[model samples]
Target: MTRFRLRSGVVGVALLALAASSCASDKAGDGGAGTGADGVKHGPGVTDDTITLGLITDLTGPYAPIGKSLSQAAQLYYDEINLGGGICGRQVETLVRDMSYDAQKTAVAYTELEPKVAALPQFLGSTTIASVRDRLEASGPLTLALAWAPSVLGAKPIQMTGTTYAIDVINGVDHLVKDRGLKKGDKIGHVYLEGDYGDDSVAGSKYAADKLGLSVVEQKVKPTDADMSSQVSALKQAGVKAIILSIAPKQTASFVGVAATAGLKVPVLGSNSAFAPQLLATDAGPAFLGDFAVLQAASPLSADLPIMKTIIAGYSDKFPKDGLDNGVMAGYTSAMVVGDALKKACENKDLSRDGIIAAHRSQNAWDGGFGSTMDFTDPAQPPTRKTYLLKPDPKAAGGLTVQKDNFTSDLAAAYPVTAG
Candidate 1:
């Protein structure tokens, strides 16, 4: 695990004080906190009576499908919580700002919304979350939840709900090799986006490959660049038995299609973010048909799981017109965790920021609709290190179905040697 060093005590105190003062107006209740006549509290972006949480997402960028769905899921959870009279007699409000997948724009949005709300519970994009990490840490421990893998490990003041970026890829690859009964020396290929996200996946794949006694033939691509024939050609030349991908939805589908076009027959395994059902429903999806595998940090969306059912039903009921995808599930899970913290915070007192963080850090386990348990007691690290592995449903054609419930066990077994 990577260790993030905290600032000196003096600097840390100054940041904490700044953060406290930012919320001082809310404490003063002078147009700062509490609900107003319209039932909204006005702060940085909050009005009277409501505690506003700001979300920065890519609503109109390459990652819009993910951002939009995630936003809807959080809204659905908020609506359900509010209907039940809210957390500690206060309604939860969400304000979303489109970041367009740009880091700079995301930083601007975060800067704009920081002083207006009681708390910024969750923000969706990885780039956006990373962009605001230092500011968040300096601004007094604002809680941020993100969808990208790198942000969880790289950013401060953000807690991830599942395995870290590198771990997700390592877990996914290990499952593919073990469950599929691949032998030692089997050639594996990786197709990934070429930045931190891709680097993390590549690093994880290398670690898994070393453990499984396999070899890797790697290919890299930009998330926005669609052409993948050249990279697929290289993987095919390597004669890989299985391929792992760490990419967004569009690129995942495109890579699968290109690989298939090059007459490659290897199974294509993917990280969690690549499990979007909508992408699988497309024409290019058949390339991934029975050959695709994914790692999910949460429970599968089966009717047998009450929590999954509730999330799906509640989200569908609340946002009837919006499409629900994996990112939405992630956002819903994030909100559920935040809600749990709020409930814990409000059990004996009002929903204050300190109380919420304390509740979060004190949790032994969380049942936030996800099958994997979340534990945050380790003060030195963020919560959540478990993961679930799934294979594409051969019967359903492109749909992913759970293969193993606690795939993180495999990762844990390999950890002593793999951790950097």
Candidate 2:
């Protein structure tokens, strides 16, 4: 509102703004906004002082702990940004929903959140994301993919953090050979759920085995089916020297527990989704004391790297009493990537969903403080071939020791973009 004092001989001036239709039509999705005749632009979830984003995670399901930790970590960054006046001077606010790691429920949640938020920064479950993608594409929100399924490459608004699960597998297998002195022809065991996530990991392992002239014994388990005893039995009977697991935390717990009961003692390598902080307290915790290793693309908290240090300091300062682990640290890093995109979107004052997507296109080998380089220009291509190696360290940040930081293998070149 404007107030003015005018004398009888003086004239009062009225200010008016003109809407630029060309610019209005030039923003991001059906989620685009209307430009007022007065030149005030209002996009979905973007207001004078607030920009709303959505977060859909597995709050109450098997990945609940992960979701909770991730959300907390994201909030830490978002809150820090907010304290600094946020992006474009609008406070960043994320509306979170728990889909319980279910695709149908995620679809419902996405539909509910689509009309109200500019983008989604946290979406867990690769297969679940795949199941509900039609719903997502219909109302395109820039989504940060927690699941690294190769099928996600080139999918609009879905930026994958790490390489595909298959590639992660390739790196892990090669690591075993070089670091663990795993010889060619050594029988390796694979225990994974029956889904895209599992398939991607298995593909990498199989590809690496073929290249190295080794053999693999696979034990497929359904996510819904809890019994891993049979799978353990099969691998044990095969005289597998080591095992790789590409499953969730609950499934991981079962794998470790069931293996011990079956007297199958071997080093277990896990994919990113395979480890959780709470797993250390489970009955199988003892078995994983030092026997379990999780392969990831992000730097572990134990690293002296700037990104890890920032996450640790910020997280500890923000939520001191809560434990810091991989799940939460991963969440923090994901938020950092999203924050970078948002900052870019703020330019030109067009914060529409489409504008955010465009911001990604300009990204080339973006560090995002995680050390992995990401190229969003060709979203379909693999972003990075690097992997971070971490072993369980309860006393360390994220409960893992950083054995390697963004390390690549000679066999990494052999990994293909098979996820697409």
Candidate 3:
């Protein structure tokens, strides 16, 4: 198992530098104008006619495939919005930065972006978000829209547009247990990366096991673990009824492939982060078959959904070369949420940080183009706690098939506290 250790002071310095540049650009007479409380004109990226939104992604990091797709989707949305006369007579512009999936780089990128943009639409990855949590909280009034699950818990000025890390895993487990009618004391095996991401799932699985009367057996792996035979062999010997995976695409696919070769046929369930269509298609192939399930926070990109159709058309028209993925949908939805908040802020012609924050919190039943609905009336709470389950499509080869649509039945009543 590969453990990532980040240098704190270096990340801080990078963030400080980025923030200074972003704010510095907001100096006198750039373009549009709004006066601050001190009677200073609104900075460069902002104008009376436009709002600049910032985005940070791991464009060249381990998660580059997902990051590139997300950035393309966000840019496409901006293009479409602008073409349609923009929001409330003002166009939306996105400033994107590549964080290279490094915590330090992500911190520096956010620092550069936070002061210039009206809001941060999407900050990708759990580790990246954690690195900047302190700075975000201390930055005062600057909020970020996040795509990572852990960011939902105890993260303020940052709203997650999906279920919390622990909650989503629990939801997946609950579905399997209820559907399969697994008895109390049924054995469940978990394979996960040995970091914050993996730890979150382990915690969630334990909670669900206690609530639903199942017994959990865990196997921890490093992010760089390419061989999962040992773990799969252990689980097979344990006679586990089911398996839950909490790792990235490469590792998850490896485990699935190895388990299949070892003749272990138990149903496998995974967190939302595990659903990478391209990776699954290329790495695991038909080996995954019908034995895997994934959680989705956004609506599926199936051509049948109206919102998805629109998004695909927009993306294809604007970003012809970049293929769509779940992260693309996540990025688009994040921007849409920010757009909603901006619309509300414009309604009152008050663009203060406090005003935008209030507007976001008051939002309820927001349709975010994913199966789940969002309600963020409490800033200190998780925004969306609903998730949809997806199964690997045996017939379609590489694609995912939706097993349940809008599985939000438990979200409203199950989770009581905001994640932190």
TM-score of each: 0.82, 0.85, 0.86
Model 2 pairs whose backbones collide: 28-354, 325-398
Instruction: Please identify model 2 stretches exceeding 4 Å from their true place.
Output: 1-42, 224-227, 257-265
Residue 323 accuracy (lDDT) in model 3 = 57
Report every candidate's CA lDDT.
0.64, 0.74, 0.68
Cα displacement (Å) at residue 155, model 1: 6.5
Tens digits of per-residue lDDT, candidate 1, 1-420, equal 001112346434533332333322432322243434643223333334555666666666566656666666777788888899977666777656677778888878777666655565667655566676777766533465665454444333466666666777777677766677778989898887776677777887888888879988888777677777887888887788888888777777777888777788877778877656776557676776657777766665552467777876777676675545566667777777777776775673534445456677778787764667777665334355566777665343124567677656566445532211
Model 3 C-alpha lDDT per residue in residues 337-365, reported as the tens digit of each score: 77788778667565556566667777788
TM-score for predicted model 1 compared with the true structure: 0.82
lDDT of candidate model 3 versus the reference: 0.68
Off by over 4 Å in 3: 1-45, 140-144, 394-398, 408-412, 415-418
Model 2 scores a TM of 0.85
Clashes of 1: 17
- Give the Å error, residue 406, model 3: 2.9
